[model samples]
Target: MRVMGIDPGTVVVGYGVIDSDAGRETMIAYGVLTASVKEKPAQRLSILYKSLEKIVLKFKPDAVAVETPFVSQNVSSALAIGRAQAVALLAATNRGIPTFEYSPAQVKQRVASYGASSKEQIQQMVKMQLGLSEIPKPSDAADALAVALCHLSEVHVSGLLGEQTPKRKRRSV
Candidate 1:
């Protein structure tokens, strides 16, 4: 399965694409989309939408997994991030791709084996898991890859459960 992971932001949105099969993950692409400060908020959002759309078209991912916003001391920052995340979701939805949201703690736990893992630790794990020569730059890109990895793991678990379970009739509740 091919998955696109997004780490959304107004100024710089990070993205990563990976292909997974039989419990192995291979990196396809990873990068950031930057919006200039001089641009208006609406323009920035437009840019983000278009950039994300192009990525979707290019990668043709089966699903998109995004990191959800965590509460921040600065309300405005959180709000902006929320808006960017909305745009990211819309882009994927418009393309008819399934989207899944994961919290930062989930992403950290999946990628680093600890919910409170540091950015450096996440980067290291992402690098090692993907067999990259070095850590992905800008931190956000690494986080995006981590989100994809988390979804891939989820997919594997779901498959295993499906194989172990037998089909049963549902009773009216």
Candidate 2:
């Protein structure tokens, strides 16, 4: 399956694409979308949405997995992240692709095998799992890749249990 993972943010939205087959995952692409901080909130979201939409069309992923925003004391920041996530969902769903969301903790547990794993640990593990020569640049991109990996792992486990689909939050366009 070809999966695209998103780590959404107002200023810098990260994305990663990968292909998984029979327990092997291969990196297809990883990068971030940036909008100037000086831009208005809505303008920034528009830029992100357009860029992400182009990516979705270009790669044509079979599924999209996005990381949900972590709880924060800064409510506004959290809300902005949520908006960014919605943009990702819309981009994929508009293309008639299925979408799934994973929490930051869930991503960490799946990629690093520990719920409380640090960012460096997750990055390192992602590198090792994909057999990359080095850690993926830009922490957000690495985090996005982890989200994709988490979804693949969940699906694999579900298949092992004789299920047709993984038990995850799913949204259709």
Candidate 3:
């Protein structure tokens, strides 16, 4: 299965593509899509959406796993990130691809075996799991990979147990 994981931000959206086969995961590509803060909000969002759409069209991932925006004390900031998350999700849904969402803690726990694992720990685990010699550049990209791997792990575990993983609700975001 090919999975595209996304860590969304208004200014920078992180993405990683991975191929998982029989429990083995391999990194296919990873990068960040950046939008200038100087640009108008609508323009920045357009940039994000177009870049992400290209990724989806090119990779044609079987599933897309995206990190949910963390609730923040700053409501505006949280909302902005949420918009970015929506943009990523829209790209997948428009292509008729299945999409899933994972919380940051869930991603850390699934990838590093500890919910409280540090960012560096998650990055190291991503590198190890994908057999990359060096950690993926740009921490956000590594985080995206973790989200993808987390979803794959969940799917594998559920299949092993002869159970179905709960589906995430889709929103217009």
Between candidates 1 and 3, the TM-score winner: 3
Q: What is the alpha-carbon lDDT of model 1 when measured against the actual structure?
A: 0.86
Q: What are the runs in model 2 whose C-alpha is more than 4 Å off?
A: none
Order the candidates by TM-score, highest first: 2, 3, 1
* Candidate 1 segments whose C-alpha is farther than 4 A from its true place: 163-173
Q: Write the per-residue lDDT of candidate 2 for residues 77-137, one digit (tens) a residue.
A: 8898999999999999998998999999988888888999999999999899999999999
Task: Kindly list the per-residue Cα lDDT of model 3 for residues 80-134, writing each as its tens digit.
Answer: 9989998999999999988888889989989999999999999999999999999
Scanning candidate 3 in windows of ten residues, the lowest lDDT window is 164-173
Q: What's the distance in Å from true for residue 103, model 3?
A: 0.5
Instruction: Identify the candidate with maximal TM-score.
Output: 2
Off by over 4 Å in 3: 164-173
lDDT digits (tens) for residues 18-129 of candidate 1: 9997778999999999899899998999999999999999999988888888886988888889899888888888988888888889889888889999988888999999
Against the true structure, what is each candidate's TM-score?
0.91, 0.97, 0.94
How high is the lDDT of residue 21 in model 1?
A: 79
The C-alpha lDDT values of all candidates are 0.86, 0.91, 0.90
